[model samples]
Target: EDQVTQSPEALRLQEGESSSLNCSYTVSGLRGLFWYRQDPGKGPEFLFTLYSAGEEKEKERLKATLTKKESFLHITAPKPEDSATYLCAVQATTNAGKSTFGDGTTLTVKP
Candidate 1:
């Protein structure tokens, strides 16, 4: 089964706190993995895409890394404005079903 799971469900951090979020997956035929950020009442904003293991990308204070079976998003000294829900999605080689998405991690940064 092609599936993705994110850990911690939710996280609360101080304005300067740093943390990491995890996304684990099991896919029958791998194609690509995606990450997105969604703010309340808004659609998701594309963050990064990973097509192979060991690929990594960064944007501002957020860094995303991928592995054969899991991915990680590391936050560096996050600020209150960084509070949002982080989501992960995966696609298989063939389109027999909709892209599977992780449950998402709701992060709240307090000032």
Candidate 2:
């Protein structure tokens, strides 16, 4: 079975503080790993897609990295506007359209 776990259920950071969120997973065969940011009641917004180990993607102040068994979301000098729930999900080679998702890490960046 494919599984995903995100650490630090919640994180508190001051504006300009940089941090990284962890996403660990296990799958029969990795197809892709995804990162998303979700606001209070809105659906998650796509951030990155990693296809293989050592793959990485960046957008604005966020960077996503993938390894064989895990992924990381690095936030650089975040602002209050960066506060949101970050979700990690993975698709397995055996599962074409289904993905296993982690509960998510809620980040609150305060000024």
How many clashes show up per model?
0, 0
**lDDT per residue (tens digit) for residues 1-111 in model 2:** 899999989999999999999999999999999999999989999999999999989999999999999999999999999999999999999988998999999999999
Worst lDDT 10-window in candidate 2? 92-101
Clashes of 2: 0
Write down the TM-score of every candidate. 0.94, 0.98
Candidate 1: tens digits of C-alpha lDDT, residues 1-111? 788999889999998889999999999876888999999999999999888999999999999999999999999999999999999999988874568999999999999
Off by over 4 Å in 1: none
Pairs in clash, predicted candidate 2: none
TM-score of 1: 0.94
RMSD of 2: 0.5
Clashing pairs in 1: none
